[model samples]
Target: MKPRLGVPSDLEAVTSAVIRTMPLDPQWDYRFPYRHQYPADHYKFTRMLFEYFLDPSFDDWLVMVAEDSLAPGDSISVVSFGVFDISYVNKRRHGPGYKPQDPVTEVENRGGKTRRDANHKHFNEFWKGQIRAYKKYFAPLGPEQMHLQILGTLPEFQRRGHASSICRWAMDHVLRKSLKDMSVMASPMGYNLYTVLGFERVGTFYIQVPGEDERLVLQAMMYKPKIWETKTTEDGDGACVML
Candidate 1:
């Protein structure tokens, strides 16, 4: 199945697919520490995240979804999804319609703090720390570089080339726009895949929660546009280099 540019209407389906696929990575599982105890809150946070990505007002980001036709009807299944942030120069910019204050206030306005509220607070701190570390250790290639924020394929759809298709789509867009490179924070499971696509590991980081036993490890990877190499091979023919 081919991947297509996603629209606001695809928000719910894409969010569900993301939540389903993300746990396949140990890092995501460790970061979303409350998933088992508070499934509803986990879903809510995931939905809000995708809503921010899909908001039409946010032109600096692009979302692509891979789908499978289930029948003769128009129904389809989302097999994989990817979100790319197009502006490396505006590195600190947030999605247009996403107001971090609103969510924080909303949670506080509920009077007493619930488990969900605590989870939100913990996750925010964790996310902020990761961003700070990223900024400290990794600098953008240039104004023309792009960031791959998230990419995942449903477990059932793994090895089907869904994720690769979306990745190639982003690379093609980068080439057309004359962008210099692309970067991503890759989980151990995805490290090999990104390496095969020509992304090199620049650094690694580990995220550990105060009371948690599991620590999440991630690799920072950067990919430069290699149009000449891509042109000589069939799409999605890149080799995976296991580390």
Candidate 2:
């Protein structure tokens, strides 16, 4: 199946698939560990987060999904989805754009049932680590790169290559749009796939609150687009150096 830009109608399935798959990610579990115990509030805030992303007016990201078309112009089963951040690629810088009391952010800040179930005590410090990793490590890569903010495939849909399909879409988009590079915060589950896709691990970073023993680490991977190489020929003309 081909990947397409997601719409508001796709929000539920996209959020569903994400909630199903993200638990395998240690960081996701660390932050939202009560998802299973508090499914209602879990879905409530999770949907809010995804809805914020899929808002038709938000152009900073392109939420791409792979679906199973059940019939001709009928129904679809969204098997997997990805949130690809184009903020840098699109020339719009997001300096922690979320304002105070954003419903989603408030959930992380201990404002409601969602926040009560979340990692209220540690998420703030953990989030600070993420920001430090971004500014100190990722920022130097510049603003012409694309980032895979998050990727999720339903647990039942694993091994179907849906994740790779979305990743390839990002790679194609990078070259297609003349972007310099593509980036991803690779989880342990996706590290090998991104590596096989030609994304090199730039480094690794950790998220931990001081005095806490638990640590969550993730790899920062970057993909350099492949393009035709040109060299000067004997006749002083440029020639393609085929790989």
Candidate 3:
């Protein structure tokens, strides 16, 4: 499968796939319990988040989707996707350019707070806390590093190298642009894959759910470009070694 840049038109399908694949992650499931209980509400919220990602003004981010077809067609199935940013510092500085309007005020102006509204507020706060914690500890390797915000493959399409392919594409782009490093907060399910791709574990942290007993463990991993050289020993043996 080849990896292609994702467009705004692919947002809905990609978001749906994300909703399906993300809960396969223990942390996502724990954070968004509504995904299993109230799928409709979950889908609505997920779509909103993806919409923000796909906004035209948010050009600092790159969304890559892996497609099965060799040629262009009317419709393409996105088996996997990776969201990358050239630099997190730039993203933070420019921002998404759109802030969500007050939903509670709108609802209350029309009527009283509904249970669904309350739930949405609670979940939003929960996620905001997560973001705050992430920002608190997320110190980039340098201004030259690229950040992998998220990466996932559909369950049926996983283990077929789709995720690896997308990762390789992004890493190549970073290297070509002379970026010094790449980084990601890897889930347990993806930790091994990232390691095999040469991302070294720098540290680990846990996300504390508001009222839940379980905390989500995330591995902080980083990759720096390495130079390898071929050398011949005095015995006439040749080997590849890091320079």
TM-score on alpha carbons, each prediction: 0.75, 0.83, 0.73
Write down the lDDT of every candidate, Cα atoms only.
0.71, 0.77, 0.69
Across 157-198, the per-residue lDDT of candidate 3 in tens digits comes to: 778899999999977876667677788878899999999999
**What are the runs in model 1 whose C-alpha is more than 4 Å off?**
69-75, 88-122, 209-214, 227-243
Tell me the tens digit of each residue's lDDT in model 1 across 59-128: 6667899997535586778879998876543443644333322233343344314445234444554566
Ranking by lDDT: 2, 1, 3
| Candidate 1 collision pairs | none
Better of 1 and 3 by lDDT: 1
The per-residue C-alpha lDDT of model 3 at residue 197 equals 95
On the 0 to 100 scale, the lDDT of residue 238 in model 2 is 96
lDDT of 2 by residue, 4-35 (tens): 88999988888888778888888877887776
lDDT for model 3, please.
0.69
User: Which is superior by TM-score, 1 or 2?
Assistant: 2
Top candidate when judged by lDDT against the true structure: 2
